[model samples]
Target: MPVAVGSYGQTQPSCFDRVKMGFMMGFAVGMAAGAMFGTFSCLRVGMRGRELMGGVGKTMLQSGGTFGTFMSIGMGIRC
Candidate 1:
């Protein structure tokens, strides 16, 4: 299925609200999956991804605290 996208993909939105909805929905699912994978070793990429997911989950619902989370989930990960 095709995902939605706003103009330039900014969160404030521009075009596809479906993208935002999908992102949020997938993000939550990913957060759960990531956390589940991290129950063992923090040194592993899976663990790191899990931690990142948890942080992002909190940030999205709280309206803040995403600075560190953003950095963690930056352009380095490719999995």
Candidate 2:
């Protein structure tokens, strides 16, 4: 009798898994982009100290959430 080998690419991830992965990736990218843009824009507007921090944080969260939602939807549809 021949022994069977284990296969690595046999299973497909669930829809929720795909969506979660997409959301996490998109959120990370969005947060980085938002931070860069927010910092520059806030500085240009003369925001300083706590105000700048607040603005940047807000921008990061909003952009991250938006990107995550869209990504999750797209990924879910692929499954």
Winning candidate number (lDDT): 2
Which whole-number lDDT from 0 to 100 does residue 13 have in model 1?
A: 32
- lDDT (tens digit, per residue) of candidate 1 on 29-57: 55555455443333454436667667545
- lDDT of candidate model 1 versus the reference: 0.45
lDDT of 2 by residue, 1-79 (tens): 3334449635566678899999999899889989998999999999999999999999999889888889888998887
The segments of candidate 2 whose C-alpha lies over 4 angstroms from its true place after superposition are 1-10
- Which stretches of candidate 1 lie above 4 Å from their native place? 1-15, 43-79
* Clashes (N, CA, C under 3 Å) per candidate: 0, 0
Return the TM-score for each candidate structure: 0.34, 0.85
Which candidate ranks first by TM-score, i.e. highest? 2
- Model 1 root mean square deviation, Cα atoms: 12.4
Q: Roughly what TM-score does model 2 have, to 2 decimal places?
A: 0.85
